[model samples]
Target: SDIFGEIFGGGRGGRSTVFRGADLRYNLEISLEQAAHGFDTKLRIPAMATCESCKGSGARPGTAPTTCPSCRGAGQVRVSQGPFSIAQTCPRCHGSGSIIPHPCAQCAGSGRIKLQKTLSVKIPSGVDEGDRVRLSGEGEPGVNGGPPGDLYVQVHIKPHPVFTRDHDDLHCEMPVSITSAALGGEIAIPTLDGSAKIRVPAETQSGKTFRLKGKGIKGVRSQAPGDLFCHVVVETPVNLTERQRQILREFDAISQQDSARHNPRAKGWFDKVKEFFES
Candidate 1:
């Protein structure tokens, strides 16, 4: 019947339509250090795979599918109503062009089975948040001999304990002793590689920023590595002993005598207040 209708171009092609498979997405989370340095990982994905019971033929043992006798291997059938003919899917074969009389017990005549598949993925260095790593032909199987779709791995970076990332740069707060802020010292700071010493000049004030070159992450597109910014936070001495309190009182008395020279910023601030009130 299909051969007779095709000779007049009134029936569909004998084969089913080819369609690409659907794409898939997987969320991948990694540490900041891993994001800085590339790593390879394996993923266990569960999806539809070709049945091994009947070699994806959906047939029972020693049996095979046969062409639909109603549609004559054509997925579509034409119905005639007096003078007009309407083409529709073959109800007998369900547009498969063939009928599986003895269905496979494993796949249940679907020609596919749910199974777990292992896939390898490579995560490049310096991959930021929301970056996608695509793997070709790693998605679901195609339909009717069509091409398979792709799988996308979305990257997410875990929060760092000490440092906060800003594009390629890194920022961190470094607590300094009040004496070190008043005097000079060489202190150790944390970097992505390890620890490094930074010289704190005399009279280093709070909120002062110290930049260390090439101490931050080298991004994927960056030719050179970024810098690390250290914010200084002067911590005041607490739980002072009686001797220390007495020494501080003596130091304060001396500093007050030369307040204009020792604390020029404080002197300037009070001068501004005095002028504002006088005006």
Candidate 2:
């Protein structure tokens, strides 16, 4: 019986439709410390708000909407097709069964206005990059007072000067002196909590990894915290004095006598190159 309305009318059965507002996304950048411990901040966003001038009625002050004259409040009109009659939405009121003779000048009959609103947002701890925090009913105001949408806050951790994140683990390059790598020493590494120390064993090679347990972030759903990995990079001595240069030269000669034992990786690489060339 109402198939004609579904086929020809703009809405269902010529009745006015209510619509939920649009959802919105916001990218939020936070420091690693802030992300690790959580923080509260205020955000000012641009959105549509209900018009105060018309009280969402879209009618001018001291006036009200009047019933549609074309449909006589039935919200529908009829057209004759041979011997059959088909119902369609009223052209005058557009199926609202009413008309505003004086539209509010401020809103231009939109019943809403563009404005900025400030909202307090709480960031939960352990929110990794790409995570979304949803705030219900905080998006654009609904159409016809139906329902509002949601606001999604996307998490993006700002780049840290000393650390890089990987899921729950954190990684950092620790520069050690050539003397420290050769003779072994204790080095202090940075963690989210603070600084911690790791012992470098004797003859420690460059690119050695030292892991600190429970020094990384704990995820939102994780039962235990992650680890922090410290990659060792042996740094060469620069601006050497004449005596320093002479001492290094003597040490190099001593190491050269037993290069295979002192520089095993370089010896192995040279051996591989020699075999490849000979073959």
The sequence of per-residue lDDT tens digits that candidate 1 reaches over residues 239-275 is 9999999999999999999999999999999999999
TM-score of 2: 0.88
Taking the tens digit of each residue's C-alpha lDDT, what string does model 2 give over 230-278?
A: 9999999999999999999999999999999999999999999999999
Off by over 4 Å in 1: 1-11, 66-73, 77-95, 267-279
Angstrom error of the Cα, residue 259, model 2: value is 1.2
| Model 2: per-residue Cα lDDT at residue 126 | 83
Residues forming the 10-long window of minimal summed lDDT in candidate 1: 1-10
Leading candidate by lDDT = 1
